[model samples]
Target: MVHTHAGFAVAGRPTRTRRSAVALAVALLAVAALLVLSGCSSKPDVVPSADAASVDVAATVTVKDMTFTPATVTVKPGQAVTWIFDDGVVEHDVVAADGSFVSELMTQGSYTHVFTEAGTVNYSCSPHPRMVGVVVVE
Candidate 1:
């Protein structure tokens, strides 16, 4: 197809304005690439710090293979339960039924919640609802 606008651009390629426009386009593309490479465009729901992981975690739940390892855990009141995200690049979080705690969507990180009351706390991954787990506090 004989394109009129394409012909005009081609005819104007030697102009300084065209060179400037091309440079601007290249700069914008470079900025976009940096954003994606640095994960600026898709930041996680929660950004944990270096000291975020608790030392007194009683039970650890491994989030992998679309399931929580040791799906049920029994712990005493005031104990902590930690959920580690290990499903490769897939993101997951722990959300309690009673709104007690909600973790950050993460592919590799951990979230800990201390159980203060004596009861069962049920939770599931927000992205994968079928991936459920329970913390039985006695």
Candidate 2:
């Protein structure tokens, strides 16, 4: 027996209750991990439309030096915002906060998303959380 500071006696070996608690904790952890991974997908929440090219892009943000050149842009409804990943050998992607858009991870490619609503959408690079940008649709 192990004596506690409060003069209570504790068992020297693990009890059945302690073993059950450990098993429960491990089971909960596995469930939590599965739930988190289930939310991930190869397809983005918002897909880039091929028609996006038909309309001219209102804003062109250059992904270089690990930052969006403009950092912010304003555009009218239905206008598109294009992100050009041209940092050369450095892979980057643009992701919207509201799940409105998501770009493919690329080193030298462009991604465009049209804003059909009037609101501000904040976004950032997945790999570089420090780099952020915003788009205000009017």
Candidate 3:
């Protein structure tokens, strides 16, 4: 027994209620983790067209040295464009000029965009406006 400031006897051990609460909390955490893990996928799902023998070209851009590589890229109207972030230190993002698309802040990974219309799409990094790129959907 431990004496409290008010001179009351306090058991210095876990009570039955406390033990049950701890066990319940742990069980809830485990269930939440299982739910999250169940939704994890191993790879990106890519659907291939059955009519076309060749797959549509997917454009890729590289972000390095605070600049968008190639700066300008042309792709077919149904093609997908992916941006790969090569810089690991500074953060960057891609936002279209006409509010078409926007990417989350990226450090070192990739983001993709598909051009469905035949037009020129200009994009720039929101944090660094000087770094710009263009996508010409033809």
Candidate 4:
């Protein structure tokens, strides 16, 4: 038999209480893990859907002989157009009349613009005003 300093008997009640507490904590953790796993399995996969009305269009203009080739281009709204500059002796730029689009001076490179509105836009080069182009979107 175990005895305390005051001569009272003890029966290991503290050890049994500690063991019960540990068992309860383990059971709670197991239940939480199971709940999380079940929640993840119930959801379906997510995928991005394309819009039926969306369209992709493009046009190209060339800078040659100090002029914009095919000076006028037309396309539908929400279309993208690209300007390719041919290798020329002088540098050229593409600036919009209403400040819509601007391109850096390039001897041989390409610039792309996306037309989002339906209207007519005029563009020209800073150094060479004669090098002009137009874009019509509808």
Among these predictions, the greatest TM-score belongs to 2
User: Between 1 and 2, whose lDDT is larger?
Assistant: 2
Candidate 3 off by > 4 Å:
1-57
Residue-level lDDT of model 4, residues 1-138, one tens digit each, is: 554443333664345456688899999999999997775532122122222235354677888888888899998887867777886667877877877677777788777777889999998877777778899998
Residues 3-112, model 1: lDDT tens digits: 23632544444455557888999999999999877753332344232233544578889999999998999889878888888999899888887778877888998788
In terms of lDDT, the best-performing candidate is 2
Task: Note each model's CA RMSD in angstroms.
Answer: 8.9, 5.6, 9.8, 19.9
Instruction: Indicate whether candidate 2 or candidate 3 has the larger lDDT.
Output: 2
* TM-score head-to-head 2 vs 3, winner: 2
Which ten contiguous residues of candidate 3 have the minimum total lDDT? 44-53
Where is the poorest 10-residue window by lDDT in model 4? 43-52
lDDT of each: 0.79, 0.84, 0.77, 0.73
Q: Kindly report which residue pairs in candidate 3 clash with one another.
A: none
> What overall lDDT, based on C-alpha atoms, would model 3 receive against the true structure?
0.77
Q: Model 2 clash pairs?
A: none
- What 10-residue stretch in candidate 1 is worst by lDDT? 41-50
Distance from true position, residue 113, model 4, in Å? 0.4
Task: For candidate 2, write residues 45-110 as lDDT tens digits.
Answer: 545643556876899999999999899999999889888889988888888888788887889978
